[model samples]
Target: MTETFVHPRAEYIDTRQPPPPPQPPPPGLAPPTSPPYITSGTEECESRWEAGAAMTEWEEKEVEEEEEEEEEEEEENS
Candidate 1:
């Protein structure tokens, strides 16, 4: 019995590619824009955070008072 072996085409397996030269994009193309309004994913994330929770005018006043008291105590100790 004789065995006949056939080889595959070379083009199908060839992996050599020239390193693509760096090129800038054409200037006329506009950048993609995101949706103007909040989406469902954004809404869920926002709900998880305290809505607009930040140091308000009253909270700032309390912090200022505490700091001043500490400064006065330091002066008295010296």
Candidate 2:
């Protein structure tokens, strides 16, 4: 008659206790949300006058497509 088996013991972590003091935001949590674009000054002078009237209507449609490609190269060189 011979039976012997017991091995389970390892837990004494007390690392000089001092790391637990930051946990207080769980009571219907709600306290941090406010900053969604809030610019002023007449909305920055109407977004710089609508970006200078969209860059002066894109430089007047590139000077009316370079004056209709110089009047279609002067009517295909007459």
Candidate 3:
């Protein structure tokens, strides 16, 4: 007995198509006209930098206070 096998065509196996273009947002739910970062000026940037520096200073003071408390506790125990 002899058997014959037929291969499937490429079009039948792979029928992939290009993805559709992105759709615009609805009129009622459109994105903001101007982003916050784009509107921010040098003054805002400077204030943010100053705030970050102040936070670091505050953290250092907290660590120093904690160290002082630990030292006092050690002295009391000794």
Ranking by lDDT: 3, 2, 1
Off by over 4 Å in 1: 1-53
The lowest-lDDT stretch of 10 consecutive residues in candidate 2 is: 38-47
RMSD of 2: 17.2
Please list the residue runs of candidate 3 whose C-alpha ends up more than 4 Å from where it truly belongs after superposition.
1-55
- Per residue, candidate 1 scores C-alpha lDDT tens digits across 1-76 of 9986766673386589989997765789665344656565434444444566465576567667879999999999
lDDT of 1: 0.65
- The number of the candidate with the highest TM-score is 1
Q: Rate the local accuracy (lDDT) of all candidates.
A: 0.65, 0.65, 0.67
Higher-lDDT candidate among 2 and 3?
Answer: 3
Residue-by-residue lDDT tens digits, candidate 2, 53-78: 44356555765787899999999999
Off by over 4 Å in 2: 1-57, 64-68, 75-77
Clashes of 1: 0
Model 3 lDDT tens row, 1-78: 888665666336556787999788888986656556746444554555677744456655765787999999999999
Candidate 3 displacement at residue 11 in angstroms: 47
